[model samples]
Each structure stands twice: as structure tokens, then as C-alpha cells.
Target: GGGGSTTVTTSTDTDLWKDIEAGVTKLLSPAGKVVVDKQSSNVLVTDLPKFLDRIASFLESVEGSVQRQVLIEARILEVTLTGEYQFGLDWGAITQAAALKGASTLSAGKILAQKFAPASGGFQIGVASTDFTALLSVLNSQGELKVISSPKLATLNNQTAVIRAGTDEVFFETRVLETPSLTGTQTSKTVNPRTVTIGVVLGITPQIGADGTVVLHIHPTVTEKRGEAKSAIGDTFPIIDVREADMIVRAREGQVVVIGGLMQEKRINNDSKVPLLGDLPGIGRLFSSTSQEVRKTELVVLLSPTVMVGKKVDEITSRELERLNKTKGRSPW
Candidate 1:
């Protein structure tokens, strides 16, 4: 009882705790000792009661910080900007409002422009605020804004969360055997059919600060199979167009930051089939009807981050419930 040890078993990023061995040991008594067990991810600390108390407090703080979570509400928008604003979306419109002046209300980091779309170019971050009310109002008033997808999710600090919009394409790889005449002209090659995922995929890894500042590591990727390409030897393969970028930025709680500059032209296809007849492969077309839409639009992402601290979730739910009850003419909580 006079001398003892504490074992701290961690789940993720356990190696990081090992680096602070010196700092933790320094807080102990001269004779106190600490050792990190890599295999078990246990930190053994033998120290006096007073020093152990301090160490426990410190560890709790770090654990709380790391385990913190953030609820992210995202809206993907597409717009068509013309004339003088061809370079990109006019973030300058956001600065016009005195409340959102200086663009400090919005925040993001390193938004890149890709080659898939000619006008896909750079953008400014750090113009976020309570919500996207004003920003959307301004854009909507001037032009039409298409909301692509609205995804709401919660993730632990520094953990990755992915949101996808669109369809999954299934293509089979074919092994082609070609019989060439005496004069060798062309040959076939083995094809490995793979699962190809196409569409807009956004990946985010966010860290929430004590003061509610959210730092996000964002990766956006857009890919589509344009057509088929033929090799010199007559081998055929899918030609894919890919646009992707990685960036980091910071914003405040409930603030919606903007990620723009990705533009794309796509052919959206729709197919309708007759129950029994459409079940056949090659003959399916005879019983099916197909349609296509050609669209040219600029892609924009609106992301709002709300960190869960203390009893914030309860407060939010209470407010929401009260509002809902009022709408139905019921009593408040």
C-alpha cells in the first residue's frame, strides 16, 4: 500500500503517450518511477500520493481532449458563375456585410483548383460564422445554387469521416483472346474487372480546440469514367477523369466554412426497365428506355462544425424538442 503503480491502457495513438515519459516522470518524487509497456499500451507509474494525484489530473485532461467529438453538418452546392467572376466564386460578396466583414467569420485552408474544370481555381478561407445564412442568401439572390448533398455526422477528434454522393459503378474485367492472321496486327490481353467507385467523395479529419475552434483536414475527390481507351495492341480500358485536392483550415463552433473551385461537366444517365423483359442482358435495351442530361456546374461545399463539450448535446436537444413541441402545440420540456 505504501508503494504502488498505475496502469494506463490506451486504445488509439498509444505511441504518442510514450514520448512524454520524461515529462510525466519529472512530476514524480525523486524515487518515483514510470515505464511505458508498448505491447500492452500500459503506462506504469510508481509515485507518492500527492504526485500521483497531479499525474492523474494531467492524464484525464489529455484524454478528454483527445476523446472530444464534433458534429459536422455539411451542404454541397453547385452554381454557375459567369462573366467577370469566371476565375472563381466571389467570396468578396461575403465581405460586403458589416457583420461578416473581413471574412474572419469563415475559415478554411488550402482550397485547390484542379484541371478537370477550366475555371476550378484557388479560393480564400477564414470567412465562416454562426451559419451559412447570409452567404447562401447572397449567392442565391444573385444566381441559382444547387444543393448537392447535405450530410450530418459526428466523429471523434482527429478521426476520419467520409461522405459520398452519387452512384457506384460495377464493371467486369474481360479476358480478350485475339486470333491474328499470318501478318501480326493486334492481340488481346486479360482484363481484371474491379469495383470502381465514381462520384464526389469528401474525407475530413477534424480537431476541436478547448475554445471551440475546429481545425479540419479536408480531402475532396471527384472521379468519372469518361470513355474507353484502346491500346496500340487493341486492348481496351476505361478512361477516368479525376479531380482531387487536400487542404487544412480552422473555423469556430456552428460556423459554416466554404470549399469551392471544383467545376465539372457531366452526363447524367437514367435508365428505366420493364420488369420481365429487362432481366435479360443484351436484350434488356429492347425493353428499357434511357435518358441523359448534360450539365455544367461549379461545385461548392459548405461545412459547419459543432464540437460536443460538457452537456452541450443535452442543451441542443432540449431546445430542439421545445421547438418541435411548440410546433405541434404541446408543452415544453
Candidate 2:
């Protein structure tokens, strides 16, 4: 009767990810000093939440003339689990039936019968050793496994006692669990890419650890002019700055990053037997694995800033607001 249950508590990473992203953004700002490393650079924060709060406030306090816009989003990715177990049984009849279904079989009864002698009469022959071995062999082979139909069953294992009471019926139970969760953010330079778009997206890689410690690897680059500048000046602007700007914006992976975590649970059982423990003709090759199920919940944080290059700050802000209203069918406040 291995029917007891256990559950462990774990910390979530949602807040941790958000704080890190905010902190990094601040470090990249004009006032903040984030020394750029060759190829890529990163900062480790023991006090993550405090650092992120400072950055967020700094961004909010920027001079109104900067014409900046910000966006944020979060979402869940996936949740899953894997489990396995071993089972036991008695009686030659059950073994034979299980064998017909390709299940491993053992003869525990035979072994005990052999070991028992009237001269050594200290114990009663409750079950034979041979039958136990045969049953074990069947269980080990391939087909002795049985699937639990109930997902919320409380007990993983349920064995029937030879002492038959007034009731011949037996009951089995299973474990229950909810789905995992996901959440993160994505940020950009310009809100509208088609008209004045530039941005970056940060995603949290799932199936990591529980500590909420995420690795921040930042790589920044400036694109160079490919073609030699014309020795002779012409009417055309010396360079295609728009195209160059596009290349520059695209070359960088947007300065923003996202983060978050979810909850997960798993259950396994051993030494359990269920009803329908019989064999059916033609179903000899029939086999089934242990029952398990998974579900998921998602969350996300999206952060993006808007900046208009040539337009007046007020005009750009107004037009952008209008565009957002028409596109999203609501105000972005």
C-alpha cells in the first residue's frame, strides 16, 4: 500500500526575468554606463529587483522631448513530464492471463513451494516462490504493465489481499496536477515598423532551472559602409541613409530581453495492480504504457519604445496615437 503523497514548492522566475530586462535597458542608456565588451557583454546583478526598478524610473523620467514610446508582452510556452514504474502480482492464473497479453510473468508460488518442507515447519505456505518469479518475469518481459484510466487517482499502487472479505471488489487511485505557466517580454525602437519601425524581441527559453537566474548575453554591432564612397560628388545624397538605417536596426537584436517561469508536478507509482487484469484472445500483442497527462498556462511581457527621426516630437506622438487607435481599436494607455 504505497498510497502516500508528496508535493514540493518551487520559486517562480517571472519577476526575476522582468527585472533583469529593465536593468539591462537602463545600463544601455546615455546616463548609464555599461562597458561594451568585444563581441558580447553582460552584467550580473545580485540585487536584481532593485536594479530593474531604478532603470524603469530612469526611462520614465527621460526629457519629454525625446519622443520615446515603449511596449511590453508576456506569454507561456509549454509544460511537460515523464515517468515510469514496476509492478508485482501473485497466483499462476493472473500470470498466465498477463502472459497472453505479452506481459512479463513470474512463478512466486513455485519458488515458495520448493523452499517449504514439512520438516522445517515454522511458517505457513501463504504464496509459492515459483509463482512469484514467474509473475516477476512476466512483469519484466514487456506486457505486465497496466494503464490507470483515472487521471485524478490518489493512489499509484493498489494490491488485492488474498483474504477475501464480504466485498470482492477493489479500488485504485491516481494523482492530479495542473498545467505549467509561461511569461516574458519583447521590446522595439519604433512602434510601427512599416512606417517608422525598429525593434527587438527577448524570449525566455523554457525547460531550464528553478532558481530564476537567467543568463544575459548582450552583443552589439555597428554596420559598416560596403561600397567605396564616390570620389566624385553627385546630386544624390552621398549615401542611402534610410537603407543603411534599416540595416543597422535589423543588425542589432533589439536592446530588450524577456523572462518568466511556471509551475510543474509529476507522480509515479510502483507495486500496483488494477482490475481488467485478464487476457483476451487475439489481444496477445496488446500492450499499454502507464497513464500520464500534461497541461499548460501562458503569460508574456511586451516592451517597445517609439522614436521618430525627422518629425517633431508632438506631431509624431499624435499621429502614432491615432495609428494605434485605428490598428488596435483602443487607446494604448
Candidate 3:
């Protein structure tokens, strides 16, 4: 045990090494020492044979080779209620129709119990990922459902996955400034072009435990460029609207969680007229008709997480990890 190297198998070398030295302090002799070589991913433990034997046994019990991966599937929707649903979406009826068979097992209580609208007491019911189609049918019957995005990605345990979809729209920012010139001070008007994305971004992090339970940290953001209007100073600018939410939930693999309660009202004007007659300043009223409509829409998100392992992990990576983690053995004399 004068000078030897032992590799960590379970957790990262840096994390395990930080606690190992203090944990075995009582067993250390004057010359005993344990150090980590992060570059080579090895832990060097130097001591007597008896002490080395104890360290070896401890490492054997604490370290193993089991790594997990996660697959995230997300669907974003916008629902516009009309006719019978003019007031708002009836989440209560939908939740009741699509019940989470073993709802008690999943921990989505407070997050799902949040109100979908100010006047409605409807709360979300737990739905298995596989059982969401039937629920979708029920939702369509309530309003006009629009699917905004469906993004999917895979990540290792304790890693974060980001899914983004949308486009960047151009705009102008104007500033009036006074500058010094060779003759005297001069007034200048400057126009700067700026861009903003009208799209959706979701940051999802999954932590899978050995028991097949997964804890998810979800953050979703969405922005829309509804229309354009003149600024106070007469500079034309685009009107933007944003809705976002952040939350954490726990559930077994393949469980579905729906996030809702975001609503927005949009105003649209419809004008119809005879081309030449409508343009006449004084008589346009005789040939032109104008109407306005207000639309109410709600944003809903559906997330489903599945714990991946072994062959499934390989399929996404397009390579086998078994060969990478294994190495030729070294004997301890």
C-alpha cells in the first residue's frame, strides 16, 4: 500500500474524495494519507497493509456501477373556450373524466390543485402518460385546443435538459441625443434594431432514485408578439405578452403532470368594405363596416418523464457504455 491507485465506481471522483479523508480520520496513522487525482480519475490511498485492507473493503461496499438516464416528453397547448365554455375552461369535468388510477402514489398535490381560472374550482387529476389520449379527447370537446409545441430529449441522471422552439422577430428602438460637432452642438436621432424571440423555452431537470422514483424540476417560459402599436413619441413598437411558471414534482416513471391556470384575452378588429368607397374620407362610412372580437385562451403544459437504463440508454447515445467504464484489473499485493 506504499503507493497505489483505486478508481471510484459509484459517484464522481471529486464528490467522493472530498468526504473520504475526514470520514476515515480516526483510522489514519502519522504517515497515512488519501488523495484524489481528478485528471486521471483515481484515488491514491497509501498506508500499511492492515489499513489498506480496511479501505479496500470500505470502497467495495460504497461503490458500484449503476448509472441511470431519463427521457423527457413535453407537449404545450393553448385552448380557446367558446359557446358553452364562454366563461372559461371547465377543468373539473375534464379532471373527473380522466382520473389518475393510482393518484395517491404520486406527489402532485398542491401544484395540481391550483385553480385553472378565477371563477372555476376545477383542479387537475393525475393521468398516466399512456392514458393522456383519452383525456385529450375530453379537452377538445370543451374548447378549441391548439398544440403549441412537442419537444423531447434525453439526459443522464442529475443532468439538465433544455428544449427550445420559436422564432426571433425584429423591432426598432429609437433614441434622441445631442452631440458636439465641429461648429456647435447638434441634435441627432438614432434608430437601433433589436430582436426578440416569440417562442417557448423549457428547462427540465430529472433526478432518478434507485427505487425508480423521479423528482422533476420544471421551468417553462413562453412569449408572443401579438400586435404593434405606436410609442408615446410615435415610434412604432411591437406588443409582447409572456407567461411562465416554475415548479417541482415527484412521481413514478411514466407519470403525466399537467400545468394550467394561465389565461389571456386578445382583441381583434375585423373591417370589411368596398375598395374604392371605403377609401373615401367622407362617404366611407356608407360602404364600410367594422367589428371587433375578444378571444379568451388558456395555456396548458403536459410533461411525462421516463427513467431510462441499459439498452435504452445505449440506443439514445448510439454507443455502448459498458466498454468505457470497464478496465483491466490490478492486483493488490
Candidate 4:
């Protein structure tokens, strides 16, 4: 039987074999490669360090873009005051006569003594940004005492004294009842006093430039019934006193601008005596003496604004959040 023989091929140049071996070694080296698994919808990569570095670079770019955006926060305040002043003088001769007639004279020096005598009243209002309604609300809440209290006057008086937007001015009117007096052939006749009105209008303009500087313009107008006179045709005309002014001021954030020295004069009359005699049938007028009082009241307004940006806003927000958490009985984050 013949034996099977295998043929073997061999190359004699060792350097050529070495070159082929080096080429195979280079192909098998640990270079990065991407493999995709279509069935599972997944991406597989071998170079993890380089992939992570690219992701880090992308996140840094996004963070830098976010930092470039900024926000502006601001707070504003408007203040106002309404004053009523009264002045009076004692009728010395009448009081002396009453004293001789066995009647006691009671002297109530001043009406509304505590409110108008010492200092003028003021109001403070604050809001975020240019919220005029909020500021007005504050003023209204604080100025309740200044509202007219006379029933007859209140019926014709304006409920609110503030000047809202769109209208340059507003007016308020009121009517009061006067004391009874003697008339022709009649024991007593009711006298209707002149109708009095107090009207106030306020105008404010704020100009804020790019440099954060603010220019404020304030205009105020006040009108009141001063007196009365008869016309040529037997008609009565009211004498009105009007006061108006314009003011300009420059201010910055968190600063106060005061518009002061606005004045108003009011007149009132009162009668006092020994209780029973003052209310007697016909001689009551003689027993009680009437004294006229005039008052001068001053009004002042204050305005302030605060601006916040970036870190300052953040700090305020954080503090607010903390306060909210405390109110809710929860730990702040």
C-alpha cells in the first residue's frame, strides 16, 4: 500500500515574513471601534474616556449659555396724605354775658385736637415693579381716617380721593346743613348752607433710562370752595380756591423723594352751653354761643424704589422660600 504524503511550502526570506507579521499585529491593536446592535437599538463603543470627554465639553457649553441670560427685579412705593385743619376763637363777650346770667360756659378748645394739631399725616405704599393698584390700595387703607364723616356731606362726597390712570384729574363735592335761624314772620327757618367741594388730582411720570437713572415728574392740583357771592340776577355763585404745582426730581433705587408743603384750610363752627339751657325752646340760641374755627393742614408724599439683579434676586427668592417653608411647618431645602 502506498503512504499518503503532505506537501509543505516554505519561504526563505525571514524579513518578508517579519513584515507580514507586523501588518497582522497592527490590525489587531486595541484601536477604538463602534458596534451597533440593530435588534436591541443600542450603541456600543470601546473608547470610553474620549466619549466621556466629548459629553463633558457639551455640558460646559450649555452651562455657559445659561449663565449669560439675566433677569431684572424691582420694587416701587407711592405715598400720599390728606389733611383737615380747623381753627377757632372763643366769643369772650358772649361767654361773659352767659356767665352773668347764671349759665356755665363750657370751652372745648379744639375739635380733632390730637389728629391735626401736632403733626401732619402721611401714607406709605409699596409694590413690585410699577404696580400702581397695589400702591393705591396701601394708600387707601392707611387714609381711611381722612374720609369725610358728616352724613349730609358724605352723601354727595366722592368715595375715593385717589387719582387713577387715564384721567388727568377728578373732583369731589359735598353739601352740609347749617344751623336754624329766625326768618320773616316765622319762629324758626331751616337754612341750607352752601355746597362745598374738595377736589384733588395727582399726576406722576417716571422715566427710567438704560443707565438705571430715574427722573420723576409730579403735578398736583387741589380745589376747594372758598366762599359765595350773589350774581347780578339774584343767583349765588361759589368762590373756588385752586392750588396747583409741578415738580421734578432725580432719584435712584432705594431712595426717597418727598413732595411736601401741600396745604388745605377748613372752617368749622360749634356751640356749647349748660346742657338743658342749650337745648331750650327759643332762648337756646342766646344761651349757646357759636364760635368759628379754621384749620390749616399740610400733606406730604414719599416715594421709593428698589432694584435687584442676579445674585440679589436669588438671595431674595431663597429667603422667601425659606419663609414659606417655615410657615408650612416644613424643613427648608
Global lDDT scores for all candidate models: 0.63, 0.25, 0.61, 0.37
Error of 3 at 27 (Å): 12
The CA lDDT at 1 in model 4 is 12
Model 2 off-target regions past 4 Å? 1-76, 79-253, 257-259, 262-289, 293-333
Pairs with steric clashes in candidate 3: none
Worst 10 residues of 1 by lDDT: 1-10
How does model 3 score by TM-score?
A: 0.62
Better of 2 and 3 by lDDT: 3
Each candidate: RMSD to true structure? 16.2, 33.2, 11.8, 34.5
* Model 4 Cα lDDT, one tens digit per residue, 43-104: 34444463333323433432332232111122122223234222211124323443454424
User: By TM-score, highest first, what's the ranking?
Assistant: 1, 3, 4, 2
Considering only N, C-alpha and C atoms within 3 Å, which residue pairs clash in candidate 1? 105-127, 105-128, 106-126, 106-127, 106-128, 107-126, 107-127, 107-128, 108-126, 173-193
Question: Using TM-score as the measure, which candidate wins?
Answer: 1
Clash number for every model? 10, 65, 0, 6
Q: List the residue pairs that clash in candidate 4.
A: 85-295, 86-294, 86-295, 87-293, 87-294, 87-295
What value of lDDT does candidate 3 attain over all alpha carbons? 0.61
Candidate 2 lDDT score relative to the true structure: 0.25
Q: Looking at candidate 1, what is the lDDT of residue 321?
A: 38
